[model samples]
Target chain A: VGPGDDAAVLSTGADEQLVVTTDVLIEGTHFPSGSRSDLIGYRAIAVNLSDIAAMGAEPRFLTVALTLDQIDDEWVKGFAKGIAFCASKYGVKIVGGNIARGALSLAVTAIGVVPTGQCLLRSTARIDDDIYVTGTIGAASAAVKDGVKVPPLELNELWSRRVDDMSCRYFMPLPRVQMGVALRGLASAAIDISDGLMADLGHLTRSSGVGAEIELDRVPVWKSMDAEIAIEASDDYELLFTAPAKEAERIAEMAVRIGTDITCIGKVTAGESVAVNGEVGRIDSPKGYRHF
Target chain B: VGPGDDAAVLSTGADEQLVVTTDVLIEGTHFPSGSRSDLIGYRAIAVNLSDIAAMGAEPRFLTVALTLDQIDDEWVKGFAKGIAFCASKYGVKIVGGNIARGALSLAVTAIGVVPTGQCLLRSTARIDDDIYVTGTIGAASAAVKDGVKVPPLELNELWSRRVDDMSCRYFMPLPRVQMGVALRGLASAAIDISDGLMADLGHLTRSSGVGAEIELDRVPVWKSMDAEIAIEASDDYELLFTAPAKEAERIAEMAVRIGTDITCIGKVTAGESVAVNGEVGRIDSPKGYRHF
Candidate 1:
């Protein structure tokens, strides 16, 4: 479904619950100047899909509201193609959307579905639950750092390869949809790492009426990045969840089956705030990119 | 049902098909400079609900992606209250959404549900069907005209009342959801008049692979406005639909029962373009506010 219709009709099979989410990406704020149109489109949909994935559901439909500063045919074509590719990649359909004139921005809304009563929620995490996160963090932050202009520095093959890897991660975030779906019936609570683990974990703890203590040593970070900064870096788009401590081994096995690394990094506690290594303190304002 | 979770999960009762649509309202594009945030927020949701109404469905959930130039607590509170009021008015749940920093914009995605296989489509109008429009046109355009700076003009009670009515229509568009739902088994095809009569009718005719012949004198316009200009003025969020010629009386009765004015101004023809009277040609670029 493209523009021109009033609305799109989708068949939601009987006995299913619909999951809905939306995210915004602005050209001058979210991405740097001179960003590729294709990547911009892909990232818009990817972030919304990550939200759906964090719900432990399968994404089904996407509606994009795109505002372009000017009508560039090539840019529009590349953007459409990129959205179509991402939709196909994750089995989601581009259902309906609106195109308008304004500052360059993309607001994507994704719809997903799961079996009735099976959706994961941040309010369900319980005290004593083990916290886990998928994949490494800080790569996107590292990439954004490199994107800024700087004087040339000495580079070895190892450093050059690392930069290339992080840049790729920055442009193409992989949503752990499969891992999220598998975590259903296992994870007590789940959230996606978009506003950094520290900030998002605070949200989870507040919602669940519990707290968490992270073992910084057990957390994974991008090469040469500090564990604290990695945990505070935004745009990771990885699943962060909690499960009963006894199910930690089973969750690890599920991750292996899905071909993603899962690390047990913390434990939920009885409180309403998140702590680092049993020390109670506020998670400071994000040093990583903040949407607001 | 809020921003803390990954996504909002909703129950879709058995055998219902989901209808979804999205619309964006950008500062300086959709509204005038220094517009009230409350009205902006209400209009954003109102437009999307109008799309759902055109599909002959009942709105159930909404996800909004709001990007602001800067964080203003009063503006945010007012915007939230406006959205809440409209959601309560229409029974739409505030499912999930994102708030980010950037150009002031609100992208609203609404999801509705209709009986299985009964949702209306633009491509279903039959040749020889009678085309009808709900409500009077040109009021919104007139209101926008009056909003701009103007020299002092005499304001008699009659003219003052008329101006107030038109401005009310401009600020608060009543989406004809109930009327659309009632027309489900009656109207052949339907579309909401967002881009005005001619452009939207062109969309309907093209989708149905048919043509339309409109009688200029039969169209209802705001006081003293030309029929052509009224038909081309945007933001008159009325419903334009086609029904069998034989059922015109019944449809008119239905409109009466629903407390709205319904006027038959045209008929579907066995061709592929919309004509004013017997003159067949393009509608040309809109004289109304064009999005792009």
Candidate 2:
């Protein structure tokens, strides 16, 4: 296992294999400066878990490396609470971590397990496979653009809140762990929409040596967000996958069983390019969040 | 497995257990702000590998999360080269990681394997156990204090160089992986000296509900540096462990076989405080590095 995929899969010489993924979120770069400490903690873990989910694994453990400008008691308390909440929600354990004094940043490594020989990969998608996405997109990106602040809540209340709220979805995007696991035997290839649908789909198709054609109007946009924004925006943490057309009905049933909306956005194609359809016209280049 | 020890051990349900450790190093905090990018990268991975070594485990995989102030191709290439060198040196694989734009910082997570029943821990030391340390201590600390600059060399040249130079020790301290593996069934408790000998020993004794008494003269200090500085300074990345008093000779023989110096530094005591003897006098309080 190496760096081309969302996470690396390590054979454990057992019935199960371990999938590991790491992500770094910096204050003023990944998040707004002075954002809620708890949300920052939650988002950091959520993003890494999304990578594990994309690999069709069940997240089991997390380790966090946090750097803070100053050691404020209340801030650390809230941050810890957020991390605890997120880990508990996903049935993941906090295995290990480190804290250092520096500019604010959070680095999280999430470990998950899947059955041996069943791990999903972006390089396995075949031409003519139907491309699908779970949950709605564009909410997080819109939240970033609009500077939406998630409402502060009592720590206990976070577990009971729904993820449909726009600001909540942005600040606390849940990783589609169940959906990814469900698609393990169904989807030919999969990736989480952290880098937008188009860019991530491009990644999947390119890795599989295939192409993709997605109808923008068919995408599940969050609320009334523009289809184009939903196509180009990132951080939705939804699963973008490819499966055979014959399995579309079963996937739709799995979606209903899991209580998530699964959308068949398009189909895989030959050649090495992603074609977008609908009112936004055709985009020749992939555009999404870039660190550089 | 959680955050108190150098690394967390996870039972793999097989004969082997997995040890995971994470450490974060920030520019201007863990190293000089303008330090060599390659050295910074090497030190970051080396420190985490040291934790795995302290756990008496064979390091197998590593993941790095790096944050840079800006995108500098040459700097990134050098840093990657450093990381590659360290990982390849220890027979470990670079599995996965992430990069983002921020103040320069590196967070590394290392995974290693050990027999399930033989994993060494700090909480298992006996009162009469003899305390031991691998190789020399305080060279890295002294080098840092003296503003020593490690000489830059060809990337290929790094592989063959011995880790005896003061500046080299500071910039690229080698983790005692072989020595640690050798100590697995022999040592009762262990920890890496990242936060200085006194501080890390305090952690081990406190965890074991025991104390320690050390004659400063017995410690294997680097060259002729003041033993006090060796006892109080941090970032040596040496293994400090305790074992049955009767095993002292056997450990010494093992050290010679492994081509590394292993010194009997002290003994575990019944009381819950560390006692220092020799020219430095008895110190009532444990003194070492504190991140906060």
Candidate 3:
């Protein structure tokens, strides 16, 4: 495993293999300056988990390195709570961490495990595979664009209630853990949509040496959201994957069993680019979320 | 296997155990703001490797997350070269990494393996165990204090040449990998001296629920470097450990086999603090490197 995939896989010489991924979130870049520290912490872990999930692994351990401008007790407390909450919910353990003085930033490294040879990769999608996406997209981007304020946390709130709030979606995009594990032997290739659907799909296609054709009308955008925004905006944390068309029914059953909506919005092609057909027009190049 | 130790050890059901450690280095805090990118990269990986070595494990895989102000092609290339250089020398692979735009910083997570039940730890030192350190100390601190310029790299430089160069010691502290592996069953407790000898000794004693008495004259300070500087300054990256007094000759023989100096500096005591004695005077508190 190397840089072209969602996470790196290491053979442990056991029945299982290890999958590792790292991601960094900086204040004033990934999130606005002075945003809630807890949310920032939650987002950092969540994003890294998304990468592990994309590899069809069960996240098991995490190590955090934080760079903060000062040692604010309240901020540190909130940040730790956020990390703990996410870790506990995902059956992950915070095994190690370090803190240093600098501009506010959090770097999280997640380690996960999958049965040997069962890990998913971006370069394994086959031609004529059915392209699928989980849940609705663009809500988080819309929340960012609209400046929504994150709501207060209720520990036992229903998932439906949490997903219905745009602020929650923006600040706490849930990693599709169960769905990803379910996808292990079913999906050919998978990627989490952190850099927008079209952009990430383009990554999968390019890596697999295949092309994709999206039926724009079938994309599961958040209610009443523009399809163009759904296609171009990032930070959705949904899964975009491909499988043979014959597996569509099995995938739909798995989605129902996991309580996640799965939509067959496109098909893998034999060419080298992603094509979007329907009202939103076509894009030849990927213009994903640019950090700079 | 937790925060108090240099690295976390995870049980792998197989004959080997996994050791993981993470560290972060920011531009101004860890190094000069405009220092050489390659040196910065090398220092980041070296420091993390020191943590793994302290655990008496074979350094294996690494994941890096970088935050840069801008995507300078030359700077990135240089940084990559530096990382590759250090990684290759240690037989470690860069398994995964992420880069983002922000204030320059690098967070590296190193994963290594040790045989079952043989990992070194800071909490296992027994009273009456002889304390020892590998290689000379304080050269890196002296180089930083004197503002020495790092010399250009020569791929096949001798270990003696690199250790003799103050600038090289400051910028590229060689992780005592082989020495650590050799100490697996011989040493009772071990830690790397990144935060000065006395300070790290304090850490080891505190974790082991013991005290330590150091004979300042026995410390292997670099050349004519002040003994005070050797005890107080940071960034040595030498292994400080404890072993049964009976193992002295074996440890000496191992040192010669590994071609690294081993100096017996002190002994573990029955109490809870550290006492340093010599011409420089005695200190009771840990004043290790502070990043703020």
Best by lDDT: 3
Query: Model 3: how far is B219 from its true place, Å?
Result: 0.4
DockQ score of candidate 2? 0.34
lDDT of residue B27 for candidate 1: 85
| Per-residue accuracy of model 2 over B68-177 as CA lDDT, tens digit each | 87889999988998888888888888777677888898888888888766667777899999999988888888888879666677655654553667877787787988
TM-score versus the correct structure, for each prediction = 0.90, 0.93, 0.92
DockQ of each: 0.75, 0.34, 0.35
Whole-structure CA lDDT of model 3: 0.81
- CAPRI-style grade of the A/B interface in model 2: acceptable
lDDT of 2 by residue, A151-251 (tens): 66765565355476676776688789998889879988888888788778777776788888888889999899889878878889888889999998999
**Rank list by TM-score:** 2, 3, 1
Looking at model 3, the pairs that clash are none
Angstrom error at residue A81, model 1: 1.4
Q: What lDDT would each prediction earn against the true structure?
A: 0.80, 0.79, 0.81
Q: lDDT of candidate 1 vs native?
A: 0.80
Error of 2 at B151 (Å): 1.9
